[model samples]
Target: MNQRPDEDFEEDELELYEHHRILVDKGQSPVRIDKFLTEKVANATRNKVQQAIDSGTILVNGQPTKANYKIKASDEIKVLMEKPPRDTEVISENIPLDIVYEDPHLLIVNKPPGMVVHPAHGNWTGTLVNGLVYHFQHLPEMKGNVGRPGLVHRIDKDTSGLLVVAKTEEAMTPLAAQFFHHTIDRTYLALVWGEPEQDSGTIVGHVGRSAKDRKVMDVFPDGSQGKHAVTHWKVVRRLRYVTLVQCNLETGRTHQIRAHMRFLGHPLFNDAMYGGDKIRKGTQFAKYKAFVQNCFDLMPRQALHAMSLGFIHPVTKEKIYFEAPLPEDFSSVLDKWDNYVKHE
Candidate 1:
């Protein structure tokens, strides 16, 4: 059986549109276009294909066709859907944004730890995308991707950092391609429980959603499952119980740094999903536990920050780099650790 063409598409990057062009083989049997498309497209159902047909987004020989139309040999079939069907509309909110840089093609914003990058299942309002929509007119939305508009890349909600938004459609493709090719330079600073044995090393493994918990990621050491992920890490500073590590990502999978570090037995401090919320190191005494608890209170989220990002300009081909300083919560936690280490 032929593999679905979209199966080869990268999921980590932004996309402009959902477009599929197929040339019917000479030996292909006569089948309804909706049925054919449902089988040909990944994650496509017959109902969805019918919806596309009804919406006149599916064309045959450059003409919109009905769902029951039978595909013929040597037929040119094209499916062009501007955006996926969204159950909820993204309402523009007049929320403030900390835009670091802006141009005709793109803009860089420093997102705070709690703000959701885009609207999702539970977060439908007050997202960064909602703010972008209100701040900028006509921001481009990713094709087949709903909720996130004008965004080329996103940082996790609890991970404070820089994110690049493509203002124009022309800028989205190249920026997305840079991420897909692993040419974008991204560095994250994380405070992890326990120091790594080595000063610097690379962690290579396949990363995917965990089987036990679908919300979190798990590393596959043998590369039997998930996407290939690589994180080069070096110790920045060593506290008594935790270490500050700088991580450079070679591949940007979901929760790559958090999962990889957890696999290395040093999950990010206060990363609840990866089991870093509790004290992983230090004495088990009541005093030590209270100190750790206080530190967690200072920074309620994961101790991970996207410190820097570098990428080539989509139009000018010039290289650009941006950095975001650690947020107050993360900084306060670090200060507490520093003081504890100094007095100890």
Candidate 2:
């Protein structure tokens, strides 16, 4: 079914913004960034470049710089703006989008749970990409199977959080570079089955598809196989049988947090893909079991959300950051736990 153009969308559970970046190549002579941008960027003028610099939207080698600053050869330049990029041929659905920020170059969105980032297999419709294809016109047509047409990165089908979309290649290139270099900052909030003995910790291991089950990933601590992954975590609050923790990713891998948490013996609450659907902690009493079952019924999926993101803007060269709050389902479940703990 098609969505109406005037249809309203749910309020974003979080905040987010867009980015575009660039890098000066070697063998280029020293030139003021304002004047230099005119020669390099399309439709950019000295006045616009100066305005971007003054607004602290441009960065030199990850640090904000002045418009008159001399950009040396090989220096990385980034730009953050609320602009949209060029267009593509994605199938436009009338899906409503929780647009956080947008310009001619890029767009930021707050994605809710139960929605896939891209289309594939049996889950082909009602994806975030379908919504974008509907909301934004003029996406550039490219050859081959363009999975995730304009996405910079992806969150899980059950994970709620922030994401950036590139409308043009100028925006995608630098953001992609930042991700490859492990420069983008991403943080997640997770509710796990047990509290950690330590207040803060780090998990370093390789993550790959499990031999027993190709659908889910497993963590290899011996470094013998899988892709390298690292997650740093700190306790937010302890709720008797469960703990809320914050996680920061050093290297993004499939199911890194869920797998690492399981390896640590604290799998995410109700994470059916792992072994968290059961009551891993708490009492074995019938009443306690009932309470946990209630919680499970309240929240059927893994309790995780992408809460924060930070990166260098591709065109403006300034540092840009985004944050999102918990959605209704997640927040309501937490409230139930909090009330239970206080009553007990």
Candidate 3:
């Protein structure tokens, strides 16, 4: 995937027309264009009208047009939304941050499960953004400049582990460069549905969206849209119906570890999206089926966590390694599986 360039926008001169992006509850048709702009553009003023038109802030049918342009059906409309001005009141709150390491240039945070790395739709507030906003003051702008302020790299919401956040633009550039070049070493611990035939192996292929379904990803032939993904796995322990594996990532595609494990006929235990029928069986096939069912029922997300992280520090220019112990949920499942195997 092509990396998005950092966009710098000063908010003093321009205002975001949030109303233009909002859904009309009634879905009414062809209201006056001027009136539409006035509602969407906050704190509309007389002078702002001319400014909107002249500066090409407002558009009619995707083309720059005057303010008085009337509305019509099937006309694609857009607005040049401005970013919010920087505020310095940002400070660390009692928002429960799992800080592993912190310094002037960067911080390594052990992001807990269910906490998103950054804000998205329906998850704007109470995200890692909310935490970072409260944690640091005057954080530098990032690539996708909206709610995500300091984030350099991201892990999935359910995937708990270490993530690097940049405090200054200098650090952000190098950290992002490291990820783009695939120099960052990331290791994950995952519980999969089946045991691999081999003790250790590597899975390499081009990852792209499945042609049959947009929601699914597959290892496709060359020239696909998705990038190449490589994962090396070693069996840590084997259960009757599942396997605990440590995975090292060579390329970080979306769901690379989980998808590759599934592709290798060993989907993560609680991964409903790719679990196949193996997940629905719960613990029924296990010696301690009840224990397995309890584990799966309580854990709503994927059973994957970033276990280790090692990379050259962007600011210090020295090697840095971080590790996170498996959370209780994962440990508990392993304990039960171990006991069951011992009895068998």
Tens digits of per-residue lDDT for model 2, 229-285? 889999999998999999998877778899999999999999998999999988888
Candidate 1 lDDT (Cα, 0 to 1):
0.83
Tens digits of lDDT, candidate 3, 152-264: 66777777788888889888878877777778888889888866789999998766555444335667536455667789999998886778899998877767776788778
lDDT (C-alpha) at residue 95 in model 2: 87
Could you report the Cα RMSD, in angstroms, for every candidate shown?
A: 11.3, 18.2, 9.1
- If ranked by lDDT, best first, what sequence of candidates would result? 1, 2, 3
Candidate lDDT values, in order: 0.83, 0.78, 0.69
Clashing pairs in 3: 91-134, 92-134
Clashing pairs counted in every model: 0, 38, 2
| lDDT of candidate 1 at residue 60, scale 0 to 100 | 97
* Candidate 1 vs candidate 3, lDDT winner: 1
Consecutive 10-residue window with the lowest summed lDDT within model 3: 6-15
Relative to the true structure, candidate 2 has a C-alpha RMSD (angstroms) of 18.2
What is candidate 1's lDDT per residue for 67-124, written digit by digit as tens? 8899999999988764443464789999999999999999999989888887764567
TM-score of each: 0.76, 0.73, 0.71
